[model samples]
Target: MQENERLARTFEEKRPRLHAVAHRMLGSSDEAEDAVQEAWIRLHRSDTDSVENLDGWLTTVVGRVCLDILRARSRREEFFEEHADPSAGPRSQEGADPEQAAMLADSVGLALMVVLDTLDPDERLAFVLHDTFAVPFADIASIIGRSPAATRQLASRARRRVHGASPLPDLRRQHKIVDAFLTAARNGEFERLLTLLAPDAAMRADDTAVRIGAAPLTQGARDVASVFSGGAEAARIALVDGSVGAVWQSKVRPIVVFRFTLEDGRITAIDLVAEPERLRELDVVVLDG
Candidate 1:
């Protein structure tokens, strides 16, 4: 086989696995795809004859690209809040099927990502690659330029932070909890739903123009459930990635998104977002229709 053809076959075999790794590392599927494409460009440009362990090499390149993208996004989210108007930008926040496009919203859980955001880019990369996806510490070290032992330590630190932020709820149970919460919410069983929530619970949506408070924050789950329960008819529910949630659709406008939060088995928070902005950076049409 020709060298390029051989390289292409190897690249194709490894690409999907690498994309999953990158997606978990960076929290955006769109960004993950970009990183993988960039990795292919780098791979083909290099002299393929000398490269060994093409899978590892390609994964490393993709990991680096994801890291760079994370760093750039972090800076934008930090320094450019004033200029961060997604509504006015070229991207249109038009049609979004919340269940389909929100990778972070559906899988990572809001609390995990918020803590992950605090990690330095390399630490976040090392931790997510090793712990979240089970990439070996040695391979992770190769990607991050650290010794395997040091990479292990980095991962440990990040794990502690994630665990401290939110105890790792069994993902399966969490999914079940989401379904129950959504049912309770849509049915307006506010009192029954209160039993499912931790006394102090929180709800936050990123598309909003202002920030809201954290938990211990509410005593009455009934009151909290009112936000979502009463409007159940306008929304549609779907189980995306094992969690039950809803999207508000209307013929005249784009979709509005909501993600439910469950704690101690009760529906405690519902993050309601109707802002036409932030939906665009998310690269999803807000499918209200």
Candidate 2:
């Protein structure tokens, strides 16, 4: 085979993994494919011989593309909001581009996506590469244009953020918080709910939820607490994308999933997902009552 065909074939083989990395970093299949296609173009234009590992080379190129897109995205968040499907929680893998779906099966669920969205662009890139994908800090450093140590620090910071525990809340701690929250919600304990929520707590619900009477966004512990004080009577402790969350179901089908972001025993954010299509894709199971 000619050199160009050889490179093309090699890239084709690595495309699935590349798409996964891009999709995790960019959160959109369209953006992920664009990044992968750009990576292929760069590979074709560059010296393949100088690249020691073809897979690593392609990954870094895609990572760089994703970083650029993320940075640009931060500047144009309004554009994203304008374009985002408020009806959906996170983009689901069902009916996604086949290549992207194959990789998403490995564990790209809404829980992680919600946490990842809270990170800074650089922190997000480092964490996704080093933690989620296990790309070495050296390779990540090159992509983000930071020193390896600096890159490692970024992942460390992101790690803390994602866990929603700077001091680190244990499973027991998280369970206790959620249990308390459920109790407060069931009894319409407004003050009790406020106590369990952070001063700056916020709540976000998808379009389906908003249309059904939930606010699209609510800020302040008092405001968020008020909305939930008389609610959650039917919410049950469940595992949402592998974490302790509340899910309301009709028989066995989940109607709405609530994912919480907790810090220091206080609820910081509540991600209420009611989009049926997206809910169907979530891995949720009710905990034993």
Candidate 3:
């Protein structure tokens, strides 16, 4: 096969993973889609003869695109919001779904897209690529143009800011936590569920979704537990990517996927990917009883 064909095949194989990385980084289905497409465009345009590790190259390109977009977004937000009234627009709500319309007010919740707004572009990219997506430090380094050690340090600092704990909970323990949450939710024991969550937990539902009356992202263990007890009709908790998480069934079908970001044995952030088009990537499978 010619070099271009070989590169094309390689890109095709890694497409899904690249899209996932872009989605998590950009937090917008539209933006992620655009970034990945841009990466592919770059790949096709560049001479592939000298390229080694096509996946790594594509990841780097996509990451850089995301960083540039993030930086531009920051500048625009500062320019428009700085001189505007504090209440010029709708106030951010706590526990609102991370989806575009809900726009939670808390700094840790979907509002965190803004807190992450504070990170330098490289720091943010390393953190998301390594911690969330489980990308290796070497690959992360390639993306950020840093050495592996430097990438490790950058990811570490990002983790600290995001409150990610070291010596992450093993998969079995993660399953146990999910089981505990499932049990508490099923029994309608709000207080017990709260005990399983950290004090400053933040909830995020996909803010860009158009689903009518979708449940809001609930922040804090206590508030989330309350929402679970009051709102959940039936829930199925399962392991996805070695973590304990649950999906809510609305009208006899799985409608929402919930992923918990844990720190020090308590849930720190709850990310709900509510966009129907993006549900498959979230791994919202219905585990049989």
Ten contiguous residues minimizing lDDT sum, candidate 2:
91-100
Candidate ordering by lDDT (highest first): 2, 3, 1
Clashes of 2: 0
Candidates 2 and 3 compared by lDDT, better number: 2
Ranking by TM-score: 1, 2, 3
Off by over 4 Å in 3: 1-6, 85-87, 91-120, 134-150, 164-289
In the range 128-228, model 2's lDDT, one tens digit per residue, is: 98887889999999999999999999999998888863332244456568879989988999999999999999999999878878899999999998888
In candidate 1, residue 140 scores what lDDT? 85
Give the residue spans of candidate 1 off by over 4 A: 81-115, 132-142, 145-150, 168-289
Give the per-residue lDDT digits (tens) of candidate 3, residues 164-239.
4333345445556766776777788888888888887777777632254545566666777776664444556543
| lDDT, candidate 2, at 277 | 82
Q: Largest TM-score belongs to which candidate? A: 1
The Cα RMSD of model 1 versus the native structure comes to 8.6
Write the residue-wise lDDT of candidate 1 on 1-289 in tens digits.
4878887888888888988888777766666778898998998889867767777778788888887788887776666555755443222223233442345455665345556867888789988887767778998888778899999999898878777764544444554565566567668787656666666556565534234222323345555555546446655543322344555555543355556676566656666555565434332223222
Query: Candidate 1 versus the native: TM-score?
Result: 0.56
Which residue pairs show collisions in model 2? none
Best of the two (1, 2) by TM-score: 1
